[model samples]
Target: MCVGDGILPPGPLSGAVGGKVKFNTTLSPPTKPFLSVSWTFKGVNIITSTSVNVTSPGHTNRITLDRATGALELRSLVLGDSGEYSVSIIQDGGQQTQGNTTLNVYEDISGASITGSDDVLIEGQSSTNLTCDATGSISTREWMKDGQPLQPSDRVTFFENNRMVSISPVNISDNGQYLCQLSNPFSFAEASYGLAVNYGPGAVTILGPATATVDTLVVLYCSARTFSPAAFTWFFNGLQKDVDEAGYVIEKASYSHSGNYTCRAFNDVIDKHATASYSMQIKGRLAQRDTGSQDRGQQGHQMTPTPTTSRAPGQRAPDAPDTPTTSDAPGQSK
Candidate 1:
C-alpha cells in the first residue's frame, strides 16, 4: 500500500520516517474457530488481537491489527521502528500459522552538494580539496569524475568518511567535471562540480608566410596549445599591435613592413605565458631596368646588326649583322 511519501520502487520493502509500514500477513480460512492472534517485534510481543484488547505501552496509538487476516499495520513510523517482526495466529485445536518479516526505514537524501576551492588549478603548482556534504540518511558515498569512478593515487586521497577528496598537486590530466553520489537502502541523491585545471599556453607559432612581395596583401596567423582558451597578442618590432586577434593583415607590403613580429599567448587562470617570433622581410618587385630591357628587345635590340658596305652613286649598302646589340645583364655582358 502507498504511504504518504518516501517510498522507493519495487525491490526490498522500505518505508520513510513519519510514513507507514505493513506486515503483509493474510490469514487462512478458519478450519475450526479463531483463537488468538499476536504480533511481535524483535521477539517482544507488541500487540495481541482477540476478544480482549491488549497492546504494548507506546504502540497502542500507532498500530492496528486485523483479526480476520492477522495483518499488522504500523503508522507514524520512526527510525527506531525498523527491525524484525513476527506474526502468529492460532485456531481451534492449537493449530498455528507463523511468519516473520524485516523492515528497513530511511529518510530521503537531501541538500546534497559538492564544495571546493574556487581558485585556479595550475598544473604541478596548486592543490585543492573537494567535499561532499548532505543533510539526510546517506549510507554510502561515492566520488566520480566526468561520469567515471575517481580512483585514489599517490597524489589523491580521501578522508573524513570518504566525503572529501584531496589532491596534493593538480595537473592537466585532472581537469574534468566531478560528482558526489549518496545512497541508502531506500533513497538516492547526487551532486556535481566542474573542476578546471589551468595548464600552459604552449607551442606558440605563426602560421602565415615569412615574406611578402611589395604592393601585395598578406596575413600572419598565430596559435598556441593550452588547456583553457588563451588570449593572443601580436607585436611588430617590439611594439604591441592594436589588434588582439590571432590574425594580422598588411594591406600593402612595403619596406617599412620588414621586421620581426612576435606572438604572445597568455593563460587566464595561471601565471603563464608563451611567445614565438617570425621575421618577415618585405621584398621589392623586379627592377624597372629589367622591364626596360624587355621593351628594348621588342623595339630593335633583338635584330641582327647591319654589316658595313661601300656605296657609290647614291646606292645604299646592304644591311647585315656587324655586331649584335651589346648585352649588359649581370653575368651576360658581351
Candidate 2:
C-alpha cells in the first residue's frame, strides 16, 4: 500500500513570544492496509497515536485522521513546543515506518526601561541600584555589567525576583556598563545602560586670555567635574553674567571682564544650584588702573568656586575626593 521511503515536512520548530502555535503532518500510503501512528519530541512522547500536536515547553497534542478528508491537524503551539518530532505508523500487519521533523521557536521580552535614574555614583562611596523589568510568557531575568555577567561583591548587589534584577549601593568600584537579561523556556531577550556617579567640578579653567586686550571679546570658562548634561551659569567679576549653559561669552569685553569668575550647575531634581568658582583677572584697560580702585573692584568681583558637596539634602559629603574647600558662597549664582 505504501510507496518508497516515507518523508515528513519539517515541523514549525518556532513560536512567537506569547503566541500560539499550529502543527501538521503528512503521510504516504504503503502496500499494507492503513494502521495507527504515534508522535514524540526529543524522545518525549507527544502523542501515543499518529499525528499528535502540542504547545511550547511541553508535549501535548492529539493526532486525528479523517478518512473522508484525508488530512491531519495539530493545535495550540508554543515555544517549548519546538523540537524534533517523530512519527511511527504500521500498515496492514506489516512492519512499521517512521519519519522525523524539526521545529523552532522565536519570542522576545516586553516593556523595557532602566531601573536607576539617568545618573548614578561610581566611586567607592556607595552602591547604586538599577533594575530591568519586562513581561511575557516563560519570563526569566539575567544581570550584566559591561555586557557581561555582573560579578558579586560587597560594592555591588544584584537582587533577582521574576523579571527584576536590582543593582544597589553603587560605588566607584562599580563603574562600568550594565544590563539585564530576560527569557522564557522558549526564547530569550535583554536591555542595557551605563552608570557614572556624581563627583564635583574638576579644576576650573578660565577662558579667553589670561590677560585680555581691551575691547577684545572676553570669555570665561568655569570647568567643573563633568556630569550628566546639567544647567550651567557663569558669574563674571563677581556678578552673574548672561552666558551659555557651561561657559560665559562677552561681546566687546571691556574692563568689566576683569575680576573673579565662577560657574555653577544644578540638577533638574534639585531646588538650589551647586557652584564652582575661579579667580580671573583681565590685564587690559579696566583691570590695570590704580591699585586702590582695583582693590575695590576686586572686592565685589571675587567669588568662591566650591558648591555644596552633598547629593542628598542632609547627607555628609560623598566619600569621593573633593577639594580641600568644603563650603562655598550660599548666595552664589544659581
Candidate number achieving the greatest lDDT relative to the actual structure: 1
Runs with alpha carbons beyond 4 Å of true place in candidate 1: 1-12, 25-30, 33-35, 42-44, 87-101, 149-162, 227-245, 286-334
Task: Put down candidate 1 lDDT per residue, 99-139, tens digits, no spaces.
Answer: 66677888889999999998877889899999999987788
Q: For model 1, what is the error of residue 278's alpha carbon versus the real structure, in angstroms, after optimal superposition?
A: 2.0
Relative to the true structure, how large is the alpha-carbon lDDT of every model?
0.82, 0.57
lDDT at 172 for candidate 2? 47
Distance from true location, Cα of 243 in model 1, Å: 6.0
How many times do residue backbones clash in model 1? 3
